[model samples]
Target: MKVNYDAQNDVLKISLSSTPVRNCDFDKPGVVLGYGSDGSLVDLEIREASRKIDNPRSVDLAMNGRSVHGVRLL
Candidate 1:
């Protein structure tokens, strides 16, 4: 998995897999979803990320009630 923010483009991209994307869906405003040929999600992109998100450059991962990782400074 990968999360990236492009300041110049104001885009936040979260890539879940390296599999090739077969199609894309823009079902919501400022959002784009990528799906693989087998209908599995591959990636997601959020446009105008800075305006919509509080912080577009950092990530903190948690699972169940525990923190898997600390705040990651990207």
Candidate 2:
């Protein structure tokens, strides 16, 4: 999985190579979006990220519909 953001286009893209993506759909007026392959979400994206999400934790919270504080890498 890889994530990229294009500030010029105001587009945030999340892609899953192993899972594959057949289409992209906006979940809530472009703020949150779903990346689907065969009707299952392979990835997710957050648009206008700077406005809605203060940090990475907010992103997880929004996507999962919960209050996920953070992600740890080791």
Candidate 3:
């Protein structure tokens, strides 16, 4: 997994390399938006810190202002 942020273009690119992505619908890629105290980006956030372990049912994620743990299989 890899994450890159381009401050100049205000673009964020997220990718997964070690594992193949499944059940994902990608449309040429885009941006995500979030509001904050300073301001907000009305674009996209390619949150890269998300992954599945053991099986595709469970995932670990980190994004925005929080960290997630032990996501169960669904």
How does each model score on lDDT?
0.89, 0.57, 0.43
Candidates' TM-scores? 0.85, 0.46, 0.28
Clashing pairs in 1: none
lDDT of 3 at 45: 53
Candidate with maximal TM-score: 1
**For model 2, the run of ten residues with the poorest summed lDDT:** 53-62
What is the per-residue lDDT of model 1 for residues 1-74, given as tens digits with 9 covering 90 to 100?
A: 98888988999999999999999999899999999999999999999999998888777787788775546545
lDDT measured at residue 49 in model 3 versus the true structure, 0 to 100: 21
Query: What lDDT does candidate 1 reach at residue 7?
Result: 86
Cα lDDT for residue 21, candidate 3:
33
> What is the lDDT, from 0 to 100, of the residue 40 in candidate 1?
100
For each of the candidates, the C-alpha root-mean-square deviation to the true structure, in angstroms, is: 2.0, 6.0, 14.6
Error (Å) of candidate 3 at residue 33 is 15
Off by over 4 Å in 1: 63-65, 68-73
What does candidate 3's lDDT look like per residue over 1-74, in tens digits? 55454444544444434333333334544434433333432233543323311333344678896889666532
Clashing pairs in 2: none
